[model samples]
Target: MASDLLIAQPDEGPVLDLAGDLSLVLPSDFPRIVKPFAIEAHSRMLWSELKQPLTPWLLMLGFEDVDPKPPWLLPGLRDLQALLWLAEQLDHKINSSGDGVVTVVLPPATQALAMLQLARQGPELLDSLWDPLLTWWTETRRKLSHFDRMLRLQLPAADALRPPEVWRRRLQTLSTCLNNPAHSELVLALIGDAARWPVLRRRCALMPLNSLPLSRIVLQGQGWTMIPLSDSGLPILITARDGLDQRDAIRQWWGSASTPPPSVHWGRGDQQGRLTLTCRVFAPGVEKADLRITCRDQKLEISALEQRLHIPLPEECHGFTPLSARVKGVCIEIEFR
Candidate 1:
């Protein structure tokens, strides 16, 4: 049996968010992992690159003991690399499309930059209001293509005495008016800039709409929506609108797991031999991962499919090595000499 935990960066778009997840194993049968065991667990990651602290434990566990005969180098279950490669190829296709044209989707960061430009150009909006204004824009705008179109709407200087919330709501209203310029009466009521409203409406209407529906990006008041496309410019539906897509995405991100050297220990109860691997996720929401185990002793081999392997030892299964457990891309191998 395995227990899992998730920790992750916030999902808001900055684009530079760290993308990879590292799983930390904290195997325990008790209510919580003991401290020394936990510390040793974190030190297992190659990213940690810490070996001095693990040397003593390595000596004690003797997990590295293996036959001196030429060690067999087998193919790895490298799903993590495949997923990352898929993501990179997708990004390249996105960036290379339309002859390196810029997207119309005004990310929150880009909106802030636009506001700063407006400040320099003598717009009444203050410097401090950029974040709040962009947040309001992001939350209220539902359409994907028309998403960044709201940024073109000019904001009037807000009263310094009023609360920040007032400014956000006011900006939302102004954005609504800008997005619906055909309703002149509504625009007049929401946006006080009578002189600028007509000009904004004309400019927004003239701006070219070149992005195809297949390639267009949108934020649906939650997060950026990803609609993958085929080469023929048709949207390739990967999954339904149900939350399964989210759950699977979380699983892939968190599934590549690593573990410290495992060793034998006393059983919890008489004859109740069990192995519990506690996997902690760097990003939250993933509760499950597939595990495949392969154990071999020179031509006498046994393989446990991801679902078939479990902790409580099955009777007739004497220990065998080298043993390997794979979680997505992570392949933890323990071979005895």
Candidate 2:
């Protein structure tokens, strides 16, 4: 998200000084109705959702016009780096950070809040000092205090003694950068392949792989399921176990196989310039009641009650537009022309 820098700083006295101390004052009617899964894991769901809004707000106040790189690019770069690391774990040749680590490059929440506090307290000093501090760290990865002292040596007596309190606050804010999570730790948490790394089991939380911008490509007859991690479109393959498809294995492990899998088939329709596709619905009452079909780019996503299927459209169907889709008996017929 793009944010405009605050031209005239707010005169409000002593805003929240730390990220942990900040709490969003949401309306009383917030989340009036909750989904079943969110209701069961309310705290986790809230944390996941709140992070989206909170991060942007803190970033606006802290970095604003000072960031050399756009803040939004930080997350995408982290995701891409994590993807390369995942490819490496799957025995694919993908380079990531040289050291096989993907660090969160964005400022941590606590540090961002402190920077905002400091910016409000003394925006004047930051214009001259912040860039050099960032440049020194990027080159030498040295402590900020080292930069602080080195800078103080060159400063004239009168300029350096302007405000003792402001100097102290600057050091405190810059110090929080040291508290950022380790690169390896953050990447491992995102990949979530605990089976390969026993150390990951010790961690309390793991990000769901599906949430990342990744796509699973099954290699038929090769006994492997390839997950494409980058825009290169080449697949990073993982050997399948016990002759079971990776998704089927997941379903069995999760004990959610009550619903029969949807069967799909496509062929040339009765009319010339038309294609017809059909999917068998096991539970007509459930699937037909609140069914939704969405086609975007080259993929079709069908969702109903407790089942979802994502099917990639054939190359031949690219130019054909969707004409009609309807449920009949225990089957859904979708026509394109």
> How does each model score on TM-score?
0.13, 0.23
* lDDT, residue 78, model 2: 29
Candidates in order have lDDT scores of 0.26, 0.34
Where does model 2 exceed 4 Å of error?
1-262, 272-289, 306-308
Report the lDDT tens digits of candidate 1 across residue range 1-337. Answer: 0112121212222121112211223233323212221212322332133243334334444644422221224432122222222223334434456232111111133232333233222213323534576555445444432533555532222232232343334333333333332311100001113234333222211111100011111111122144321121211222223333243443443333222111111122222354432221111111123223344332222122211211333333445332333222111222221
Candidate 1 stretches with Cα past 4 Å from truth are 1-9, 16-268, 272-294, 297-337
Model 2 local distance difference test score: 0.34
On residues 158-221, what C-alpha lDDT tens digit does candidate 2 reach at each position?
2222223433344333323222222111111112342432322112111111111111211222
Alpha carbon lDDT at 1, candidate 2: 6
Clashing pairs in 2: none
